[model samples]
Target chain A: MRHILRETWSGLKRNRAMAFAVMVTMWVSLSLFGVSVLVAEQVDVMKGRWYDKIEISVFLCTKVHGGATDLSANTCEPGQETTPAQRELIQTRLEANPDVQEVLYESKGERFADFQEAYKNSPIKDTFTAEDMQDSFRIKLKDPEQYEGVMNEAVTLPGVQAVQDLHQVLDPLFAALNALVWGARGLAALLIFAAAVQIANTIKLSAFTRRKELGIMRLVGASNSYITLPFVLESLAAAVGAIICSGLTVAALVKFVVIDRAKPFIDTLAWIGWDAAWVAILWIAVTGVALGVIPPLLSTRRYLNV
Target chain B: MITFDDVTAVYPGQPQPALHRVNAEIEKGEFVFLIGSSGSGKSTFMRLIRHEQRPTSGKVYVAGKVLSNLRQWKVPEFRRQIGTVFQDFRLLPGKTVFENVAFAMQVLGKRTSEIKEAVPEVLELVGLTGLEGRRPDEMSGGEQQRVAIARAIINRPKILLADEPTGNLDPATSVGIMRLLDRINRRGATVVMATHDANVVDQMRRRVIELVQGELVRDQQRGVYGAE
Candidate 1:
């Protein structure tokens, strides 16, 4: 062990600059991977928490001759009006369902009020008045998986015309975010792999340049492990240095870049915060070691040519 | 004792075998000169003893271990028992003379005290006792070669293989290096040196094994360098 360490120490000291260069390269590459993985995980967690709380919206039919009828004129009989009593019945039924976690009743006037606030300056806001909207029951299910069951039950209700899960409503937004996350992960992996290869090649070339010295060591009775240990250790040392730098960079980006820029949105978001910092830290450290070990193992094996 | 039983070596990317059907043996404490012109397989023979290249079709037994049949892991252990020096005086350029000599023992995992004890003793034997702290660049060619010798013998190997040890030195310096190797041989370590220097070889009057065009041409006890 001492022999191996002595060899490692000598090698590192001999090419201190090259070692440092390799390390810096590893740090930047690995930091990008670490940060991206953490952000994706955090995004997933946010999706889980928020999607669990989302409500399923059930649109009520129009009232006709003391009964409910489909709101669209094309689907409705001659004269139909969606009544308050029909909406009340639907809301009560949704509230009593086994899968229903809660039910929120929204009257046409309330829907109009929300719409006016949602699109205050839009031209379409004045075109459709509060009375033109259908009364709806927003039902929160116990789990997101129960959404289909709840939607089926809701659409079959006496006064219901249609039911929609909000995820389907926000599908475009979720899809865009998911695509961004996966794209970032793919890009990060590619860059990190390139960096690892770069590091391996650099170390390999260094070994080749010093083949004469290594041959001398061998002729002079230096053990095989002793000759190999320095190259391995040099790679590891550079990796460690790079990993540390990458970790710090990741932490800094998370703190100053992501969190700072997203502060307003994050503050209003009910359940996202710094709880993922430890997980990020763990990922960074693991990435550093893996990046350090894998390439060196390959490069040294080739360098040894045994 | 080292013996070659009809050993032949063919290196890759070469047109022909470097050594061909060579048979010889050197008993313990024998100081022998391996004489040949360049490309006459002198270096190849040296490498075979060190197991750098295995014999293509025959056996090479060094101190009872067959070099051709040795496994990869056993190679380093095998080399540790046989010291080797090269023509270029392969000293670590960045290391001090003491460190270079101490390195041999260090690789064998000898304790610090053992290194502290052994390195100085070997340096004294090589006549580089006071130049221990100097790097290779700071020393003369002869001094660097002495450092290489000290490194080779520090582990107290049973056999010392010198491939053109004085090929790059002046006659005076070459004689000095030869005498040091001779002294080590006298102390019971077998010395096998490959050289073309007729003056040193003739003066030593040791056993000689000569090779020509990859074949053994002569083997003479009390041999002269150019006796062919």
Candidate 2:
């Protein structure tokens, strides 16, 4: 074992150029793999934050239970105004539901004030009044995903103007993010394959150069593993270098880009912690090492017959 | 000890066998010379004993292990009991003579103290006492072959197979290598040398096996180089 260790270190020194080339190749490949992992991680964090904030917005009435213009198929029927008693009864029912958490009542005057505040700098603020604003109840649920039940119960209520869901708006954004994560993962798989092949190529090259010594070792009764260790260790050294590099790069990405940029969102809840970043780094490093190792085990067994 | 029971080797896709129904044996501590011209299966004869090429028919027994019956993974363990030297003196060019000699023990997973004690002894036995730090390329052909001998014998193998160990050396150096092999054989390692060197074979006064066209034509007890 000592001899194998000595040989492994010496072999790295003897084949430093190939070792460096392999390290550089693995770094690039593992970095891509790390980025894919981080991207997936960041997407999960964003989804969690946005999903919690998602609410079923029950728009009550602007003109009445029915309006003048036909909005859509799910639009509230055209009638007189939504009665105050009916609105209060609907609010009470929403608050009583176990799925509902907190129901916020927004009158037309409140909605108009919010609009003016949102568009405070725009000249368009002068064009709209509280009459143009619709009154609605923003219903926060215990679990945001159980929104279908809320929509069904609220839409048929007497005072409901129409039901709107922020979840619908957030779905497309989440869908695009999920797509991006899957795309990165697919590309990462390709990069990992390329990295594995490059590792095998590097080992083959090292074996070719050391053919004479290898034959001597064989003649001296060296076991297949004894001969194989040096090649394995050389590639493993490259892998270790790649792992540290990728880990640091990934940590930096999570710190500066994901956690920092999404600070405001993450502040509301525990989205991405250091534990998640650390876990992601470890996961990628282990994967990189495995990819670097399996190739030499295969190629050497085939090419060198050891 | 080594024995061949009608061993024959026909390489893949070859019309003729390299060795044809050739039977021979040599006991422990004996020195023997294998003499033949080129293509007379002398090299193939050495390879058979090392399990480098298995017999297409029959068996080869080396120190009680059958070459044909030996598992592929255990071939190294079988070769461990035997030492091998070559015509080109296959020493690692990048390593010093000390490292080359130490490698023989290193592969066996011998302890450092054991290797430290054994390597110098073998180097001295092979007359390479002062050349431990020199690389093969820095040495002469004879010195390089001496390093090869040092490596082969460092592990104290029971049988030593030398295929033209002195082939590339001049007459004087060839005799020197033969004397070294003679000394190694005297120390209880069975030495089998293959050569067409009439002078070295005539001088050794050892048992001789002669082959012609893959057939064992002569097995002479206490033989010289040839009939002449």
Candidate 3:
């Protein structure tokens, strides 16, 4: 072990420039990967936090009688009054559904009031007065999974117009985030592959430079395994150095940037536990060992000749 | 302790064998010179003993082991028992003279305690004690050759093969290298030096083997370096 260390140290010193280059390559690639994965994780946390409190908006329609051009729209359609009795009956039916955790009834006037507050200064505000809006039920479900069942039942009601699931509203954002994660992973893979090739080339040149020395060593009773141990250790040292640089960079990023800024959202998601830190460490450590070892095994093939 | 029994070596993409029908024997402590003109098989025969190239036919044995049957894993061990010094002085430019010599012991995984003691001792044996810290480029042609010699014998190998060890040096430097080989041989290691330097070859008056083309033309005891 000591001999291997000595040999590895000498090799690293002899090719200090190459060692630094590999270090920087590893640092940059892993750093980029670290930040990207953390960002995706944070976005997921935010999604989870927002999903729990969000409600589904289900719109209902009134009967069309004498078409008064829908004037006094705040009032029910002409001869199509939805009396208190009719409203109570709809409420009773919704409350009886198994998936319905809670149902809140909001009249068109209330929706219009909420809209007025939501879009206070928009020009479209003038076009959409409360009277032009539909009366709706704001529904909550026992489980997020039951949303589709509840939505399907609500939309088929006699006066219902639409049942909007809030999760669907966030689907596009989640999909975009998923795509970003995959894209980052792909780019990281390409860069790591290039780094491996670079490492192999570096080892090849190292072998070429020491061919005669290797020949002499072989002659002087050094076993093939003994001679190979040094080169393998050297390659691994460079790779491990790169890995350490990358791992530290990743851990630091997670600590200083990701956790610090996303704490509010992260705290809201209970399942996204602190075990993520351990996983990151293990992943980076494994990546480092892999980067260090694989190239040496391959490059040793060519160097074994001389 | 080396013998060649009709050994022949044929290189790829060549019209003729590099070494053909060669037979010779050297005792354990013999000092022999392999002399020939350019394109002769002097270097090829040296390579055969070192197991750098196997004989294409017949048998080649070193220290009682049939080299032809030795596995690849055993080649390094075989080589370690024999020392080879090239004409080019292939000292690693980055290492100091001491480190270069110590590298031989290091690769053998010798203890650091052993290396520290052995390196300086060998450097001193080659008349390079105080110059241990200098890189190869910092030394003269003669000095670098001496360091190469020091490296060769660092492990106290059984045989030492020097192929044109002084090819790049002046006559004075070449003579100095010859004396070093002589000193090593006196320490009980067999020495096989391949050279074109007739002066050094004739002056040594040791056993001389001559090669012409791919054949052994002469093998003489107490020989002179001439065509007689």
Candidate 4:
């Protein structure tokens, strides 16, 4: 064991430059891989948090400028406003629908209050009153993905002026975040492949240089594993180095970018925690070690021929 | 002990077999010379004994184990009983003489204490007592060959195969190397050497196996190098 380790250490020392190249390549590629994992987790967290809150807002007929506006303009006559009976009927239909998980009534005053709170910093915040706001039904669906059926029905209702599925507002945001995740993952995959090839090349070169020693070892009756172990260990050492580097890099990214910078400013959305960071590091470590060990193991068998 | 039974060996991408239907046997502790011109399958015969090259047909038995039947994984274990010395004195260039000799035992996973004890004794036997710190390039051709011999014998292998151990040395130095190999043979390791050194072979007057174009032309006991 000591002999093997000494051989491995000497092999690394002899080819330190090539070994460093392999480590750096693995570090960069694995960092990207780790970041992609974290990003994927972030996308999932965002999807969960925001998707849970998504609801269909059905704006009912409202009296504006002494004429019915919104859904009333399409469903009701020009001067027709939503009657109390029509509002009650719409509420009962939404509540009875199997896809509708819950229906909450928001009166004009409540809508106006929400608008005021949302746009408090605007100059026209005080200009809007209860009469200017539309009464609405916020419908939470049993399955948010089933919104299209509820939305189409809500739009044609007697009182509803507009049916807005919140998913439409959130889908593109999620799509962009998902694209970022896949893009990073794809690039990381490419870099990891390149790192594997580089490791193979390094192993090939190292084997070529030390072929005389290998021949001597073989002639001296060393087993195949005995002859191949040092090369494998050299690559594994580089991989371990890369894993630690990538792990720290990913942790720093999570700490500085996600936690320190983004979390403080964007506290409304949950960011990835250290648990997710650890998961990503675990992925990087596994990938890094595999990348480090496999290439050399395969190439040495070919090049050493022992 | 080594035995070759109707062995024929053809290397890849070659038209002619390197060795063809060669039959010979050497008992334990015999110093045998394999004399032939280039391409006479002398090296191939040695390789067969070491299981480096398997016979294309028939069998090669080294210490009662069939060369052709030896599994790929077991070849190393089989080769442990046979030591090999090449013409180039295949030593690690960067390692010192002591390291070169100890490396053989090291590869076999010998304990450090055993290696420490055996390496110096073998070095002293090879007449390289105090040159332990010198690398191969720092030594003369004869000294380098001695180091190679020391490495080959350090494990106390039952069979020592030397393919032109003194091929690069002058006649005087070659005589010295022959004497060392004779001493080793006297110590009960079967030594098979392939060489074109007529002077050494004629002086030693040991068993000689001669090959001609992969055919066994002669196997003479106490034979001279024969009329060239």
Candidate 5:
């Protein structure tokens, strides 16, 4: 056991440059892997926070006074007003829909107040008043993804001027975030492959340099495992160093980037915490150790041959 | 004891066999000299005995075990019973004489007490007692070869195979190494040495096996270097 340790130390020292290269490669790759995992977790958290609050708005036809023509009108005819009986019929139909979880009547005054608050800093708020706003039914769906069916049926309702699904506004943003997740994951995979190749090269070079000592060991009746243990240990040591580096990098990213910077600015969405970072780090550590140990074990078996 | 029954060894990618249909045997407690010119298969003979190479067609029996049938994992354990020495004196350049000798026993997973006891005794036998602290570069060529011999015999192997053990030594130093090998032979281990030196061969007056172009041309009891 002592001899194996001594051999491993000397082997690592002799190939310190290549060992450092292996560690750097593994560290960078594992860090990228952890970041990708965290990004995926962040996407999931954003989905959970935003999808639960998504609503569908059904705009009722409104009266236009003095024969005014609204060129931007959708389902509403120019100068047409929805009667109270038509409004009640529209609400009754919406409530009967199985996909609708809840229906709340929103008056024009309430919509106008919300519009004013949302565009408080814009000059556009001056041209909009309670009379210009459309009265609507704001709906919560059993599943946000089922908005298409509810939206289609609401457009066909008697007094509905237009049907708007809020989730449409969030689709592009989620698409971009999902793309980033896959991009990071793909890049991490490529870098991990490069790290494995580098590890194999380092082990082969170390074995070549120590061929003489290995030959002597074989002649002295040293077992194959005895000859291979040092190289495996050297690779495992490099992997351990990379695991620590990547774990700390992932933790710092979660703390500084997500928790410290993003969470406060985007307070509406819940961000991933240290637990997610730890989960990512655990994955990176497992991958790092596999990359560190398996390649050297296989390479030494090929190159040493004794 | 070793026996070669019509053994033929052909290295990969080479059309010519290194050893072709050669047969010989040497009993225990015997010191035999393998004398041949370069490429006469002397080194291949030593490699066969040490289980480094298997016979291409025939069988090589060492101490009652057929070497061709030895499994890969058992090769190390099988080799512990047969010590090997090379012409270049394959010692670790940075290690002291004692460490080099002790390394042999260490590879076999011998206990510290056993290694601590046997290393000194083997060094004394090889006449390297006072030079235990000196590294290989600090020693003369003869001393380096003595360290190699000491390492080989430290495990008390049943057979010691030396391939041109004194190839790099001067004539006077070669005699000193031959004397040390003769002392080892007298200690009940079979010794097989391959050499090109005619003086050592003629002076030793031991069993000689001569190979000419991968074929055994002569096997004589109490033979000299040449046919005459």
Candidate 6:
């Protein structure tokens, strides 16, 4: 066993160039794999934040629907604009529900101010007045997925003009983020495949170089595992070295790049924590070792057939 | 210890068989010489016993086990009981003499104590004592061959094969190597040597098996070279 390890170590040292090539490829692939894990975790954190904060905004009657003078098709209905009685009754019903966590009421003036801030430096800023705007009840649910039941009940309420979910506003963004995560993972898969191939190539070279020794080993009654062990160990060592390197690279990425440098760009995003980083490192390292062992184990089959 | 019953080996991509309808048997404690011209199936015969090549037409039995029916995975265990030496010395180029000899035992999963004991004993037997640190490139042809011999015999295999073991040696060194083989045979191991050296064959006058164009043309007990 000592000889096998020593042989692998010396062979790796002797073929430093080849070993370096294999290590470089492994490092790049595993780091990208790490990056993809981080990206997925970051997206999930952001999704959780957004989902937790999402509310069903039930808008009251606006000027266009409530300001009509006539009592015809264009006229205001008896309860077109929300009255105190209607709002009190609906608020009582919402508060009575088990899934309703909290409900916040926003007056027209407050909504107008928010519109002004949202449309700041734009031509549509002062064109809208508080009187013309609609008031709303932002309904927070115990579970974000339980919004549908609230929306169904709130839509039929008196003076409720529209039922708007914050999830609608954020769905496209999450979709785009998911696409990016899958893209990163796809590229990682290809790079890891290239790494596997490069490992096989380097192992084949090592096997070919040590073939003379292998023949002698075979004739001397060396077991098949003993014959293929050096090559497998060389590959595994290189892979493990690269895995640790890539793990460090990922740690630096999460610590220095994501949480630090990407803060301003990702201001609203919930930064991925160190727990996720460590998980990614552990996952990539284990995967890298397995990936490293498989290729050479296959490639050295014929060489050890002696 | 060995039997080739009408064995014929035909390699792929070659029309003519390497050995056709050949038969021979070698008993234990026998030192037999296989004499043939180049391509006369002498190497094939060695490969047959080594299980490197399966006979195309017949069965080969060694120690009562059939070679052709040998399972692929079990070949190593079978070869473990046999020692093979070649003309090129086949010593690992960069390893020291001690490492070269110890390698034979090491590959077989020998205990460290076993290697530590047996390597020196075999090295001493091959007259490689105190030169254990010398690499193959630093040694002469004879020293290199002796290291190969030491490695081959460290297992004390039941059968020792020498395919022109002294093909590249001086007359004096050849005589010495032959004496070593004779001593090994006298110790009750079967030794089958294939050689083209007329002087060594006639001089030893051991059991001789001759092949001509893949045909077993001669088998004589205590025979000289080419004696009908």
The DockQ leader among the candidates is 6
lDDT of 3 by residue, B1-228 (tens): 999999888899998888889999999999998988988998889888888777899898899999889988777777778888888998889899988888888887788899999988888889997998999999999999999899889888899999999888999998888898999999999999899888898889999999998899899998988966
CA lDDT of B130 in candidate 6? 95
Measured over the true interface residues after superposition, the C-alpha RMSD of each candidate is 2.4, 1.8, 2.1, 1.4, 1.4, 1.1
Native contact share for candidate 5:
0.65
User: Residue B23 error for model 5, in Å?
Assistant: 3.3
Residue lDDT tens for model 2, A1-306: 877777778879988888888888788778888888777877787777787878888887655436654342134546556778888988998998889999999988998998999999999999988887888899999988788887788877776777888877888888898999999999988988888988898788878877887887788888888888878887888899988888888788778876777676547644565777787788777887797678888877853342
| Complex DockQ, candidate 5 | 0.54
Candidate 6 lDDT over A1-306, as tens digits, reads 887877888998999999888988899999999999999999998889889989888777655766543221122244467777877877887777788999889999998899999999999887878887878888899998777788778767766767788877788999999999999999999999988988888888888888888888888778888888888888888888899899999999888887778876768767887888998999898879987899999898986564
Can you write out model 2's per-residue Cα lDDT over B1-228, one digit (the tens) per residue?
899899887888977678889999999899999998998888889998988888889899999888777888898888888898889998888789998889888877898899889988989998989899999999999999999988888888999999988889999999889889999999999999999789898887889999888899999988988775
- On a 0 to 100 scale, what is the lDDT of residue B113 in model 3? 95
Q: Supply candidate 5's per-residue lDDT for B206.
A: 96
Q: List the residue pairs that clash in candidate 5.
A: none
What is the total number of backbone clashes in candidate 1? Answer: 3
Identify the runs in model 5 with alpha carbons over 4 angstroms from their true place. A13-22, A56-167
Fnat of each prediction, in sequence = 0.65, 0.74, 0.79, 0.70, 0.65, 0.67
The prediction achieving the highest TM-score against the true structure is 4
Tally clashing residue pairs in candidate 4: 1
Q: What ranking emerges by lDDT with the best candidate at the front?
A: 5, 4, 6, 2, 1, 3
Task: State the RMSD for candidate 2.
Answer: 4.5
Q: State in Å the error of residue B50, model 3.
A: 2.1
Query: Taking the tens digit of each residue's C-alpha lDDT, what string does model 6 give over B84-167?
Result: 989999988778999889889888878899899999998888788999999999988888888988888999999999999889
Better of 1 and 4 by lDDT: 4
| Candidates 4 and 6, the one with greater lDDT | 4
Docking class of 4: medium
Question: What is the per-candidate TM-score for chain B?
Answer: 0.97, 0.97, 0.98, 0.97, 0.97, 0.97
Number of the top lDDT candidate:
5
Which residue pairs in candidate 3 collide?
A: A219-B79, A219-B80, A220-B80, A221-B80
lDDT for model 1, on a 0 to 1 scale? 0.79
